[model samples]
Target: MLAVESRFTGASGLDAMGAAVADALVPQRLQTPDPHRFTASVTSVDLGSVQLVRASAPPMRSVRPVGSPARPDGAAFLLLGRGARGEIAGGGVSAPVDPDHLVLIPGDAAFEVTYPERVEVVFVALDAPGALRLGLAVSGPLRGLALPAAGRALLAPALDAVQAAAAAATPADVADLAEVVEGALGVAVRAAAEPVADPRAAVRAAALRLVDRHLRDPDLGPGWLAACLHLSPSTLHRAFRAGEETVAAMVRRRRVEAVARDLTGPAPGPGVSELAARYGFAGGSHLATAFRARYALSPAEYRARHGSAHHLRRS
Candidate 1:
């Protein structure tokens, strides 16, 4: 877990925390009835596929949810901890969550969470797609779900262990935390949603995760992805067929997109040949050809147009 703690105070604190909140967690607008009295703080631990975030303030009003266009990418599950009364309204549903409750806040829906007084909440952040894999009822609002006594017995301690290990985690421990979380949450998600199971969606997400993590491995292929995901190659291909792209195609697209970002960024990033080899391309020409197909500009041309301004600034 990569721990990041940010705090703000005084007259301008809430505004500053808003920008920081947008970057670290979600892109949303925040307001407080009284700015001078509002102090906001958030601490996040990046645990790969999921993140753990603790957010607190005197009182707040927020708009634009994580899955909304204003701020999209991840979904949130909030477990209220202390000192607040709140209402969340989204996707034509309204629910009140007390300190003893938990709620799944869908990523794509525009919603508002209002707090009346000083309060703190723990959020387990999941990639919007992974939420689907876990069979979360994400099409709309899902609230007031708590673990059964037995389920809570299994979950609460696992999370507490993770939190205790968060501040002093080594790289290997952090890498393993995602697997630990996915396994534990997989059980919890199933216990909560008992009827619906999308094995294809789960397998598809696993393949995507493998591709993202092993992009630098030159021999990444369907076989490799299958092995890592504990599925046969045929099963892997079958699972991915439900999506728009085939397995190989998706891997290629992600690699090309990554190289394009590096080339088009402000800093004097790696050269084309280096970028190609680093991202599992055969060479610079291989990367240039694919980049052109995707962006309509060769790597060199794209770099010249987007990155030269930064070079000039540096000079």
Candidate 2:
């Protein structure tokens, strides 16, 4: 089980408040004062809840904490709103952040955050295993970078989910919120890996990952995929090309392969239509067109030819 708490109060000394929040947020802590008058608070938790510390500081002129030790236990993702400008200095590179941008910092690295004006910022801390499972660096120092378009699309929803979860008071709601936070972390890590300019490729990659994660969904068509990847119809098609495949073809191929793999076992699998729809085929007939083209046999025939041998081995 994971735990989370939130704190909000006026600042006596902004530096002290910042330091307190930083200590509560990460093991390695630092803070600085800016010229603006602001109201700030730290919210969420680190235990599978997509820990976030957010602050809205006063405008014009900012200060940043410098030269903190690296945190080796977890990774961090930072989101800066449009009213803020800042840079992170670490790992032999200085990464800058614009409004609505995100930066990911791997665990086991040291860095500093700076702001030039009163800005709203959010920092998410993810556990080591969660970070690695999401294809982010497991260990080593990391610098910050901007969240690309595809990333922004994916993260914005997740962020909202986490924020809502953090505010939930009921135990059951908190548990459900934890799940949402975990999902948000997954989305964040995947988004961090996306290329900046070519959001189409990112969308395709994200869609493929989603399909791989939820292969059992019967209605996982291009429309569903497009919504999940935050792309339009034409945009999703372009992304498929960027990923070196057509969307419809890719869905058909993935469905067929999933069914084939399922058949290559001892257990009686779902029927042809069931398996076909599970992988997003429009219908049995549509599945047949592609399945026969790829395997030179209808779904039932192919299953009959290959299923027995594989089932026998398993048995």
Instruction: Give the best candidate by TM-score.
Output: 1
Clashes of each: 2, 1
Q: Cα deviation of 31 in candidate 1 (Å)?
A: 2.1
**Native-vs-model 1 lDDT?**
0.69
Per-residue accuracy of model 2 over 1-315 as CA lDDT, tens digit each: 233444434445455555656564544333445323444555545434346655555532332334554343434455445446767666676667654456666544566666666566666666433443354543344555456666666666666556655564455565466566567655654566633324454455556656766677766778987665445778778767777678877776777777778665564666656665567776767767888888898766776787754222211
Q: Where does model 2 exceed 4 Å of error?
A: 1-11, 27-39, 45-49, 59-82, 191-315
Best candidate per lDDT, number?
Answer: 1
Q: The CA-based lDDT of model 2 is what?
A: 0.58
Cα lDDT for residue 87, candidate 2 = 71
